[model samples]
Target: MNSFEHDVAVQATNDDAQTTKVNAVERGYYEDPFVRYFARKGSRKSPLINRGTWVRVQAVYDSVDRFLEIYRESSCRQIVSLGSGFDSLYFQLQKKSLFREGDRFLDVDYDSVISKKVEIIRTNHELRTALRADLTQLTNTCGARTDQYVLAGVDLRVVEDLKRVAEKVAGFSLEAPTLVICELVLIYMEPKHSDAVLNYLSSSFTELLLFNFEQVGPEDPFGKQMTKNIEARGSPLMGLSAYPSAQSQKERFQKLNFNKVAAISMLEYYSKCAESLQDNVKLRIRVFLVLELIRMVKLVQEMLIQLFPMVAQVCKRI
Candidate 1:
């Protein structure tokens, strides 16, 4: 099927009567096995698109675990996942016992989107009942403890509601550490929203940030292609504006007075955990120019030239 046709076909399957086929628990952009299975079920004409979809899924999740690790290490009891979609962070943390007695977990997502998820979690015996049982046992096995857990539906783009919940949960004191994960959400907004978010996080939260972003500047070939594919899939590319070049990203944090700033290419992050990735999964990460703007940029530039000799020729010509 053509791209639009494929999207239509996917949408058709979401009709009221047809919806009974999937059940409450499995309804998400990525949750449906068939959508994923077939979306990756490639044809000769669009192998790249299929592979890219798989890569996108893998990249998002790969980063998720990494973000979770940061959360675990922050030693913060309170955890907030901004723009938490079908993210399994809370479930994973619960299973791993990453939070202590005073730690609180809150998931902020759009009301409509989260309502569906909440319904699924509420109705599905597995997520609420079976999965919890399984995780509770695992938590016991791992000795990971938590004081409290809560999932509140809020729009991250709307600062008022998000701030209210944050204040209520963590309070304005900022005495205890709070880990806030914005993940891939900010990119959907204009740069102004991103600026506000960065400033808010820096001021309101204490200690540590795990930010994952993309760059869509005119200079990037892969980025251009990636944006085309995203829109082709019939999903709004709202977050495209949020990605910035390495220098721009560095300046953003610096503007907000972030105490310690370290930047890593998505490629570097993937490489750091390469040994741990599963065999069935394939990961392709490129942050070509973005990484070039980090501390000691010249050194990383020299290394990139060594690793990608062809790029060096292209750069010299440019």
Candidate 2:
């Protein structure tokens, strides 16, 4: 079935994301033991690609971590990942104990994607064991649930369908602190359709934190190239032009009646993430030492190249 927000080409992007994430993990940009299972073997990526992938991955992980920390005393909490495809967050959180008995982690996506994911979970012992999942009771169009986790197949544009799954099926608490993650999912649909979903979330949930990581600035040169490339693949980012920058995102959320809203470009987000880490004295010292060692190595290499050449000329003349 064709999803309102994610179609075939957009579905394929899941594998691309997986490959890119696995590449970043392999290169020590981050650590994700579960991502490799969802990704097929692929070629190595450039440092820029790795860093970008790391930024996106780390953003969601850190966001979830902070949310859990802030809402630790709450009786109920929920994390809803829109268009979650082969995402490893559930497994990661399970290991970290951040997503425990009282907190719900729901993954929503197209029926086909969830079906395949359920099938994979059935066969993959590691994934199945981690979630303690049973595929025998998979919903006809949705997916399975184990303990605090639920995977539902529902179109985001249809607010009623999403409401049914979230409220009745998945048992998401409306009064709970909720973290809604929509990474590169909404931009596939027209602004009207995406706005409907956004409106539904902003209004329905009492306490909500919606995190969206999406492409913006289709008019810029780099943005134009990105748009052209994705369009060539038969999936144009329709909402990109509507919400073309971080400021636009913030304004859009504010117009939706969100009390608190902030948006930053990917580079700015990366810098802020680095700055947050630098607050830790141990990490700051380690980073400083690493940089100093690199500087010393470069200096020694320079001396060997230039000074050694001059010394060889003098010895030959003697």
Top candidate on lDDT is 2
Query: Which 10 consecutive residues of model 2 have the lowest summed lDDT?
Result: 307-316
TM-score per candidate:
0.59, 0.84
Please report how far candidate 2 places residue 164 from its true position, in Å.
Answer: 0.7
Tens digits of per-residue lDDT, candidate 2, 209-289, equal 877777776775666767899888767887878877667777777786677776655555654566665345335434544
Candidate 1: minimum summed lDDT over ten consecutive residues — where? Answer: 308-317
C-alpha-based local distance difference test score of model 2? 0.73
* TM-score top scorer: 2
The list of candidate 1 runs beyond 4 A from truth reads 1-76, 130-147, 169-173, 215-218, 232-243, 276-318
Local accuracy of candidate 1 as per-residue lDDT tens digits, 1-318:
354553343233223112331221132212333322112222222222222233334454554455456456544455566666555556655565644555666666555445554555555554564235321111111111123544455545566666776666434335444555655455555567656766666766555444444443423555566567655655434544444455555656677667655555544543565566553322221232232232444443322221100000000111
